[model samples]
Target: MAEQEHVEESRKDVLIVACGGSGRRVFAESEDILEAPVVFINSNDSSTIPLVPSGMEGCHGDPELASAIAFENVGAIREAFQGYKAVVVFSIFGGGTGTGMVPVILRCARDCGCKTISVIGIPLSFESARRKLAQGALGKVSEASDRMYVLDEDSVVRMCPDARVNSTFRMISHSIIFTVKCIADLLSGPFFSTFFDKVYTFAYVSEMNPVKAVEKAITASGDDPAGGIVVAVSSDLGEAESGAIYDKVAEMTGMVPDIVRRNDREDTKMVVFFSVWGA
Candidate 1:
């Protein structure tokens, strides 16, 4: 593999690793996966997001296609990252197919010499027996990931004080998708694939941090609150969104972090931006 001599722009070469929420198995086996050009994995219809083409059984396109998607299968994640400028992982909660896939995908990115980060959405403990498998999923990435952003649905909703489970999911999912949309928007920009996007960075909340914000958010939610705007601003955050950003981060952590400033020295950006929900 050819090695990069230096770091360049912000949103250029890219690798996106997305896991299927519920219908992964279905899409995995559905001929649509092989048939469609690309399919965004999901358990259900997510309002009005752009369609990534459903992978069917007999669909045929370019044999040498630039992109390849495998629903939630980890075995093929590395393949998808091949030649990618940067890798962004988006998975709904942990466990099952996605759980096993996170580590392998992270390892693959590093092995391939590409900048990588894992963006994971952890489900609430009270969600259901199947929904709360984040422990295992988060454990692996937390150790190996350069950047890990964890969003706790249970903690985020409690901030409102009146949001229910359904409402919480909607709000959380929307926020997640919204953040993702920002990324996708970056990808859509002309300067993205050209001037920038080769480097990698991460941002997310951590297991050990301030206890105030997490406590307040959780107490209000009536459940365990350990969530906040967990993020690791990869590129230069203009130097303006610093203090206020930290203040908001303090709101989530309940206390200020020891280190939350800009560091753009490394060509390979690796940050773990987290959002704590409970104290």
Candidate 2:
């Protein structure tokens, strides 16, 4: 396969919006580390000012009636999202504000000619009503978004077997943040510059070699090898070790990947982040 080098402009027009109380909570926890500008849309006018970034806009409507209100006053929401090329929307799919407003927000983004990515959190199995609502909302989201990442609460729980409720919630939040960061890093960071239509992401920690790690991450991502792949490795591996992993990925994907390496002092295990992008 011929190596194709496609360099595009940096993703400076990216906008990250958190669409409900749960979304805002995750943003608040991760705002300090996030690299992109963020907007918070909520239903209550409580004390979110402290959680939100200064100078950024926050839209408040009625939580129970967010969908109606948003549809009625879409001009205002569209104005808020003006001047963005790509939009990343974060929300929990089961709640009233998050569920109702996500589709509206996604529609607005799409109408504005912006690429839209929705990161939606699914409710736990015990919350049957919430799960049902999430299932209903997911259809609308799928129609509205160009790409979607569904974070399953059950999968997170399985990952953290003995964790408490609060810890599980934190774990979920962290996973969302990590995903958003990885996407931003791949699109906007100085490492690589290819404009991709869809991205599939998966992360895994293993003691195996880089080829096995790539295989595991690819299987977990559930992405077909039809487009370019970007890999980020976080480990204490030396230069030669890292190069070996990169070579394995290039061999498997038949394309030169955008690679990012990080040194982890405390852990010896390699954590590989795999992102497969659609052409």
Candidate 3:
């Protein structure tokens, strides 16, 4: 079991891929955002994989998934991740860094003989010109990562009662934080009971008028809800108006999400991940 201290770069190796952090407009004499250290907290001292926030190069505004770090950091990541059995990547959707960086990190992990799974949040709402950007990047991401699990907010909102947009965003954030924290807590606790074999996820899509299709599918399967993170991935969207769909989601779920959009070919898909915790 690894100690919880910040070890030197000379120890084990686990790579963290931070995509294009070049978004920040650097002043001539400004300090660099890429220079920020990546932070990691393991679920337990025994579990091999260490969870860390992505380090980007040009980071600013919404540090959740902005900026770009270095592929050079991969060496450090590998060293840190060494001795761990697996890799857990928490990332955002179809942006310069998260999408771009995750693939690179996964490749490095694969080369290093580590099993990699990218846990991403795909866009489930109409916030911007999502069609143009997110799809292309996701194509690259899915091609690289093994077992890509996505959570979409678009379909998740309908699961909730009526709620406002702001409230919905908060709700979404709450779930994301909840799921991550829950896993962390379990790992940290004095038990190896339920995990190392738990895989539960929800998918949300907002293309081809799939809402009715969704209703029918859920009705058929009798899927119930226990709120958590919704990873939404989509590439099959037509011309979408800004924030219209997401706003509707806000009204329906009483919780909104921080949307991460991915366009993977013609398949515009969304996945919502939630949890029903044990007492």
Number of clashing residue pairs in every model? 54, 0, 53
Tell me the lDDT of candidate 3. Answer: 0.40
Candidate that would win on TM-score: 2
Model 2 misplaced regions, further than 4 Å: 1-11, 46-64, 189-279
lDDT of each candidate versus the true structure: 0.43, 0.64, 0.40
Please provide, for model 2 over 93-171, each residue's C-alpha lDDT reduced to its tens digit, 9 standing for 90 to 100.
7777788888998999988988788888888889888887887777788778877666656765655568899988876
Task: Tell me the lDDT of model 2 at 9.
Answer: 33
Task: Using lDDT as the measure, name the better of candidate 1 and candidate 2.
Answer: 2
Which 10 residues in a row give candidate 1 its minimum summed lDDT? 58-67
Write out the backbone clash pairs for model 2: none
Q: Write the per-residue lDDT of candidate 1 for residues 1-279, one digit (tens) a residue.
A: 111112222333554556555223222343222221223333223201222344432112211111132223334445555666556666664445456545665776776776555666666767565454565456676555555555555555555548776766555655454344334323333323221222222221222232333334334434222332323333444454445445754664465532232223221222222333211
**Deviation in Å, model 3, residue 275 alpha carbon:** 17
lDDT of 3 at 248: 42
Model 3 clash number: 53
**Best-to-worst ranking by TM-score:** 2, 1, 3
